[model samples]
Target: MRQHLWMICASLALVTASSAMADNFGMAGCGLGSMVLQSNGKEQIFVGTTNGTSASQTFGITSGTSNCKDDAATVAAMYISVNQEALKRDIARGNGESISGLASILNCSDSDALGTSLQRNFGGIFQNTISDSKEVAVQIRQSVYSDTTLASSCKAI
Candidate 1:
């Protein structure tokens, strides 16, 4: 009975080990090192060291390369944060260069439609007197993501 129990424990250990090996990224996460090394085992040390030494992981996360992809909503939020004032005016009026620029950044086909949609939802986005750009950006992202026309037209949504 003891021998049988030991065998069962060993089998479970093997299963756990194999499952861990099946993971896509190693201890370093997705980066140039992980892409080049191609191992989720001891090679992770080298992968992690490479990522730390080169800072490629940050670049990979930002540029959507090396198995790391950037989120569209995050990109939109960043854009909104930078151009908060201009975007607010544009969104309020239902048209402007800032709105068109944001639409282009989000990969939306029709900037006009995006502007109009945001114009109608201005109250929800600004919320009376919210001055924080990041908060406003999040609201803009939510508005875009929830709109059928903007969401469908915007690739990043």
Candidate 2:
């Protein structure tokens, strides 16, 4: 009787684990790190298995939380934080590759328009000591909500 109950419990655990994994494929290092799982929701850290977290850490650029920022949508948030100085320089330079790269990372549609908008709004959007990826992400996501065609073409990250 105990053996049968154990089998049933293991089966349920497998099913629950598989279900949680299905939620985010792109988030799993674009494809490779699927076997490993990460969830702060789980109290035990997947029964002390660090396989998934290690794989995620190995693939730094792919992990959304790679940058170690407080709040980030994905690795892109980390990129934004890391590149703040470069972005500031690019915005100051006016309509160029760095601005375009910034636009691409932020998921904006029009490179020129985003460059122009960031150039125009640099003073307000960026700050001296703040990385501001979360703040900028809020603005971009809000663009999807309130305004979609404001030349910047902000989209949800």
lDDT string for model 1 (1-157, tens) is 9999998678656644554333257678877666666667897897798788889889978886666764566667778888998988998899999999889889999999989889988998898665688788877888888888888899876
Worst 10 residues of 1 by lDDT: 15-24
* RMSD in order of candidates: 8.1, 6.7
lDDT for residue 56 in candidate 1, whole number 0-100: 86
> Could you tell me the TM-score of candidate 2?
0.50
In candidate 2, how many Å is residue 72 off? Answer: 6.9
lDDT for 78 in candidate 2 is 63
Model 1 quality (TM-score): 0.67
Off by over 4 Å in 1: 1-30, 37-44, 53-69
Residue 93 of model 1, lDDT score: 96
Instruction: Residues 21-109, candidate 2: write the lDDT tens digits.
Output: 45332232322233333333452344233335466444543454432222225645566666667766776665777667756765677
